[model samples]
Target: MPDRIFLIHGYVEDPTIFDKLVPLLPPADYVPVNLADEFLRWQPINSVDARQVAQYLTNQYKITAEDTVIGHSMGGWIGIHIKQLTGAAVVQISTWTDQEKIKFPTHNLSVLRFFLKTGLTQSRFLTSFFLKQYPFDESTELYAHLLDNANKMSRLYIWQQLQTLFAKVSPLTVQPDLRIHARADNIVAPPDETFVEVPGDHFSLVFHAELVAEPIRTIIGNRPITDIW
Candidate 1:
């Protein structure tokens, strides 16, 4: 049987973010988990989210070992924990190492924090406004969908996630098997090894799914499939 490939999306993002990229990947059983989906009900901390994902894999898919897990940003953080639980090989994209934190401007972050604390983040208009401040293809439908997903997430859930992001990550609990980063990425610090550098900013990397998927297919040594584009 082909290896299972699990895709974990980052904060304020849903599984659909990987829609374009998934089809380009080599043939395999693909599972994309939306962290935001259970945010309101679970209000999960990082560790909790990881455990839940591990449990989901075990109960639903009977996944045990040697699975390929890919995560983006905060999702990458959770992926490391899943790796520990399942002995899975992990690929983290634009993910921060335990030593690093996202370098958002303090002023802007503070403003965002205030909104989260006050529940203003629940408003689609405000959430969209905050998201628009980031570098993305604002004209694209992907951006619109992302904004919609962000609005669906609860402010409390976002606050908890922000806390997890800023919290100190334990040292090398589980190292990623491969790291992918963009030269122009503003969200996370660049990785040191086993990395593939691609063009575009952080969000743009998702938009240019082929660039991201091709390197992953190579790393996994999966048979080449025809390009979707």
Candidate 2:
């Protein structure tokens, strides 16, 4: 059978995050799981749980041992939990197993969380100013998309994710088959031997799909597949 590749997106992001990587990968049944509908719809933060999302995806997709799950950021965390249930191979990009490994801009999440509670975080001025001051994105066009996304973003959901994300001692229970991180990633603490450090920030998969896609393609290509292309 053809290799199954499942693409899981992160918080508040749709399946379109993997658009650039899709065509670069080997032909297969590419399933981009949608886990952000609720977040995008402005649901309560308390309602969103990574484990719950993982469980839903596991049941919804009936992911098997032969399947490969590639996830970005928070999606990687969800994928790890799914792997624990489905025995599927997981690839984590820009995700940290250890809570201490996540390096937030300010160690005091309370300050950030407090700001997230207000409408200020979603304000056009604040969002645009942030993009200009702390530029993590690579594309000029993406800058505009991000500003647009901020308007639709739910600060409550992000606060919830941050609270739960750091509360865990070790979120990565299941070991992934491959780990890739960005060298200039300001969000996560420096990666060790477990990850192949690419040149980009937290969203390397978006701006630098070529850099990230090669290894993913190679892994899929080298794997034994019964399907004849």
Best candidate according to TM-score? 2
- TM-scores of all candidate predictions against the true structure: 0.74, 0.79
Best by lDDT: 2
- lDDT by residue (1-229, candidate 1, tens digit) is 4567788887777776677777887767778876555455454454433445445544555555657778888778777767776777787877866535476554244676897777676786776775667665633465566668666766666765665465443455667777778767766767765578877766544667788887887767742212211
Question: What TM-score does prediction 1 earn?
Answer: 0.74
lDDT of 2: 0.70
Q: How many residue pairs clash in each candidate at the backbone level?
A: 0, 0
Give Cα-based local distance difference scores for all models.
Answer: 0.66, 0.70
Q: Candidate 2: list runs displaced more than 4 Å.
A: 1-3, 38-48, 105-114, 154-171, 225-228
